[model samples]
Target: MNGADAQSPVIVVGAGLAGLTCALDLVRAGLPVRVLEAADEVGGRVRTDRRDGFLLDRGFQVFNTSYPQVKRRIELPRLRLRPFTPGVLIHTAEGGRIRFTDPTRRPSDALALLTGKQDGKPGTGPGPLALAALGPLCALDLLAPPRLLKRLPELTTREELARWRVPDRVVDGFLRPFLAGVFLEDDLDTSSRMFHLTWRSMLRGTLTLPADGMGAVPRQLAEGLPPGCVERASPVAALSAAGVTFADGSAADARAVVVATDAAAARSLVPGLPAVATRTVTTYHHAATRSPLREPTLLLDARRRILNTCVLTEVAPTYSADGRALISTSVLGTDAPGREAALREVLAELYATGTRDWERVGTTTVAGALPAMVPPWPLSRTGRTASGVYVCGDHRATGSVQGAMASGTRTARELLADLRRP
Candidate 1:
């Protein structure tokens, strides 16, 4: 049924972070928008599940307290936040562990490499090998300048390592592992623009989480919308100028159709969609006997396989009941293999605690979770081919929740302008 002919209203496909945000924005604008979700529940990747009175998130995710876009767009109080206690611990196999905190309090944190007693640790800090790599890696912040990325396409991880007069030892020991945690990619093959964006954000905010798991953000977005505005478990098979056809042969019409799903799903719905790049992030959640670390730190393991380990409970105690905690290990390269044996091998390499009789609480590997925010990442496809067709998602903006929300708001703003254009 055409939107002008249907009994309902504007229909948005996929009630993920972007879709929900867009729908809420449109509804608040009094556009009478409706959201359609493929899953039974809301929150595409940002999901929270309750088990044995403990709240569990689908994947290991964190939010930057400095996310300017999301912070300005949403009323964060709705999703109780748990801020990290101003520091991160890097647990290493050979070098031992060190804590890096906010530079404001410990101004020495920023000069740790030059200062011999940085963060109260031994040596000049981060070791000579790691320090050597920091030179070019730190220079990446320069790319954040206005439009600098256009001229520095060749300034990628590989390029920076090769050009910076740094040694191969520094690249291997420091740059590789450090960049892995930031980009979640084993290699530096990603675009230099993404590298700069990550660096800028690093300079921008503190790392934090919602008390109710990462899912709370999406939940808040969904609840903000009008009742009966979102239809769950209805996937859009194809979309045309007339309207959308669901997998069950049901159709819904709208004056404007927004594709707020993942890149692959958008390709299926919109023919000849822009080329998209994808990356996988593997999260290992452990229900341990005791809390691993009291404070949250981005663990950079020398093993190369385990990118980072985040103690979620310490970051946000509300995620688990008192006396119980949740720890997550994110593997950057590939999705955890389906074969139990391979998974066990990877886990053993990650936690150094071999996969054994310890019961696992929950584990997830997001195959299409992260976008390759590298160079050539596509621009916003909002206000695409048709007058009433729109697109919004992380794939259309930066790959973070902030990016997704920004895309949605921009779409709504543009839509409103289009309505008033006449």
Candidate 2:
């Protein structure tokens, strides 16, 4: 290494959002930093693919505007974000559809509830009066600031919901599938703290997709950094307190090292690290001549065959070209044989249309999509593994994009503070 190169720049492993965020913060502090990524591009799990004129995200993902870290780091207007309708459509087990909309966004729907006009809807889900009554309580409980949520005793999400007086019908019909999709689990065993935070985020801002794709998020972060700071397709074979060794038998010296890869990779680098369970998710994309559901609303399956599905083209027309519609479906855990056929059958029933003509585009399975947030989960953990060695990722905190960025920022601040100490 040259004299300048050997001068101890902070080395960051993996060019995902967490690593990129840390690098950007370090750069802003006028500190020299280097990022190594195994993939050819940044964004790790957050990627986009263009196939047959369809922009398919690596997995079914959504960008929330309410994440404080996102607001601080991202230029929202540049993304040209397209939003899903502020509510969801539930396909009931009885083969009926129920529409649950945010009263704040669609006052007409609220008015319909007040006038008892919603009773005419297909599914015998929660009645309008019941839904309207719960809205205020939900807003007060979930939309409260983070400090308030932190004060509450930690509990599993299912237990927390049990404490609430929400009707069983509402929980089973809507909240179950909806929260399952978010937590990537059907049992609602995630941390109640995470549940409240996620609920607050959703209530505070819209769920959106960039005009380009989810990959645009990481691209934006990477673009803001100094050129050549991120070295793609350079995988680190092992790590130590001093620096890292590359797969090519090369080594780099650094004052500090941050392992910002996924949970599995981070554990590999630092043995005996606390284990964080992860959830798996599989997303299937298909093309249709016309949209099965014309609205840009997420549809949840009450039967739990499919966690959640959305018409991506309806939410953002750029996802598809030539008037073709793109439908994205997500299922929890690994897919089994005949899963595609079973999913298609479920889709046909849910949309009340035939799926035989829908062209299957592709399927992407992420085994470690999000770290499982169980009770007693800490909002933030000390990123330091040892002197000069640290780690951060979704596993170190909550399991959302917001959590990932926040953890990265925390690592950056901690590293800077430690480095400045006398």
Every model: Cα RMSD to truth: 3.9, 2.4
Give the per-residue Cα lDDT of candidate 2 at 234: 96
lDDT of each: 0.68, 0.86
TM-score list, all predictions: 0.83, 0.95
User: Which residue pairs in candidate 1 have backbone atoms (N, alpha carbon, C) closer than 3 angstroms, thus clashing?
Assistant: 3-253, 191-374, 191-375
Score candidate 2 by TM-score against the native. 0.95
**Which pairs of residues have clashing backbones in candidate 2?**
none
- Cα deviation in Å at residue 285, candidate 2? 0.5
